[model samples]
Target: MLFRVDPASPVPLGDQIAACVRGAVAEGTAGPGDRLPPARELAGSLGVNMHTVLRGYQKLREEGLIELRRGRGAAVAGGASPGRARLARAARQVAEEGRALGMADEAILGLVRAALAAKGPPPLPGPGDGRP
Candidate 1:
């Protein structure tokens, strides 16, 4: 996968790494069973510290997007299916729109929560639901 981090951005290096990985997975450049570069190697290549790369990997692990092991490094964990990606994109759009309208963070989150409550349980998977 092509990884990049903007040292000039206000966002933390770790956060930038994590976001890049997420975007790659969402775009299918990386996918289930694909192993990520080792932390040390990636850090050396990206000109960042190993700790920063590890932190990004840890975040992905916590989010169930990737698995990290002592010797195995990190691997995509099949978490970013196309449907989930679509939902994530839609949520970002909603948040942006809410901000443009001058809504508070809590208000935007509450609006999402209300919509979830209004929708109730999601429909059960049918044929070709993308499960592997």
Candidate 2:
């Protein structure tokens, strides 16, 4: 997977790093069980602080996209897949924008529900559902 960041961007470097990983996951280039480059190495290569890369990894961990192991470094979580990663990114963007707009959680959820209503309700995905 490739990691790149724009130092001049208004966005934090850590967030940019996280976005790169998310994009890789969504593109199916980095799948479950794939090991991510060590934070220290990635930081060196990207010319950012190690903690910055770590913060990015932590964000992925929070999103359930990747897991940080003691000696094993980081790997994509088993439940993570291209489709799920894509939707997860979209969901996060929606929630962030809603919060930035000062919308209440219920109101935000209601909006999501309304949008989803066009599909007439979705059943929970199960095995062999082909969601990824």
Query: Highest lDDT: which candidate?
Result: 2
Could you give candidate 1's per-residue lDDT for residues 10-126 as a string of tens digits? 878997898777787788888888999999999999999999999988877766778887878899886656455445546657977999999999999999886775597865546
Q: Mark the regions of model 1 whose C-alpha exceeds 4 Å error after superposition.
A: 85-109, 121-132
* Location of the lowest summed lDDT over 10 successive residues in candidate 1: 80-89
Model 1, TM vs. native: 0.71
Q: Which residue pairs collide in model 1, if any?
A: none
Q: What are the RMSD figures for all models against the true structure?
A: 8.7, 7.9
Separate clash counts for every candidate: 0, 2
Most accurate candidate by TM-score? 2
| Model 1: per-residue Cα lDDT at residue 64 | 73
Model 2 worst lDDT run, 10 consecutive residues: 123-132
Q: Scored by Cα lDDT, where does model 1 land?
A: 0.81
